[model samples]
Target: MAPEYALNGLFSVKSDVFSFGILVLEVISGLKSKGFYHPNHSQNLIGHAWKLWNEGRPLELIDICLASSCMLSEALRCIHVSLLCVQHHPEDRPNMASVVIMLGSEIALTHPKQPGFFTKMESHEAGNQSSSTNEMSITLLEPR
Candidate 1:
C-alpha cells in the first residue's frame, strides 16, 4: 500500500506539482513547511511567497541557509515558480511539461491564484485525524 504522503491516490499530478513546489522551498530554506496552519491566515509558504512577490520583496522570504551561497535571481525565480504550482485551482497549475519549460526558459509566467484550503481552522484537526487513523490501523494489524 502507498504510504501517506506518497503522492499516490491521495494526490493527482497537479498535487504532485504542489508538493514539488513545497519541496523546492524546503530544499532551499532547510525548513519543513506545511500547508495548513494558522486559524486566521489561510496562507501557507506558497501563499506567503505570493504575497511577498506581490509586495516586491520576494527575497525577504529566502532561507538564511542560502544567505551567502545562493544567486539572487535564481533563488527568486525558484520561489516564483513554486508559487505558480500551488495556485488554488488545480486547472490553474501548470503540468510538469510546462513547468520544465518555464524553469528552463525565460517564458512569461502567470500570477498564481489564491491557494486551496477555504479556512485554516481545520488544518490541524484534519491532519491529526488522518495520522491517527493510519496509526490505529497499523497497530490493529500487528501481532500482540
Candidate 2:
C-alpha cells in the first residue's frame, strides 16, 4: 500500500492506480519495496527499480518467474506502465482510463518520473505519520 495518507483523502480511482503500480513492480521484480533494505543510501526496491530504469537496463529488474512465460515486449510494457503510474507527482500519473489505453495501444509512452517515496526513510516517515493520524481519528462521531 502507498501509505493511506499519501492518498490525502483523494483516494479515488487514481489511488488504485498507484497501488497497482507498486504491485506491478513487485510482481515483476519478485521484491517488495517495503522489505527491501540497501546499505548504500538505504534505498528500497522503488529506488533500485528507478536506477535500473534510468540506466536503460530495466530488463535487469524482471523476475525469474517470468523467464519463460513472459513476452519481452509485454513485460517491458508493464514496467513502463507501472513506472508511469507511480510518478511522484500525482498529476504526472495517469488515470486508470488512460492506463488501460496505454496498455492496449502500441503508441510511444512518455518518460516516467521517479516513483513515490524514493527512499526507505521517506516511506517509513510517511507510514508513521499515517499510523498516528489513524490512531487519533478512532472516535465515531455523527456526520453533520
Compare the candidates by TM-score and give the number of the best one: 2
Query: Model 2, range 1-144, lDDT digits (tens) per residue?
Result: 553446575555566788888888899988876657544545677877888899899998898888578888988988999999887767778998998999899989999988887765655543342323354556788989
Candidate 1 per-residue C-alpha lDDT over 1-144 given as tens digits, one digit per residue, 9 for 90 to 100: 111224334655587777677777676666556533434455555555666678889887777879679888888778878777766556777888898998888888877666543234345553442323353443456677
Model 2 error, position 37 (Å): 3.2
Q: Which stretches of candidate 1 lie over 4 Å from their true place?
A: 1-10, 35-43, 118-144
Query: Each candidate: what lDDT?
Result: 0.65, 0.78
Residue 48 deviation, candidate 2, in Å?
1.1
RMSD of each: 6.2, 6.8
| Number of colliding residue pairs in model 1 | 0
Per-residue lDDT of 16 in model 1:
77
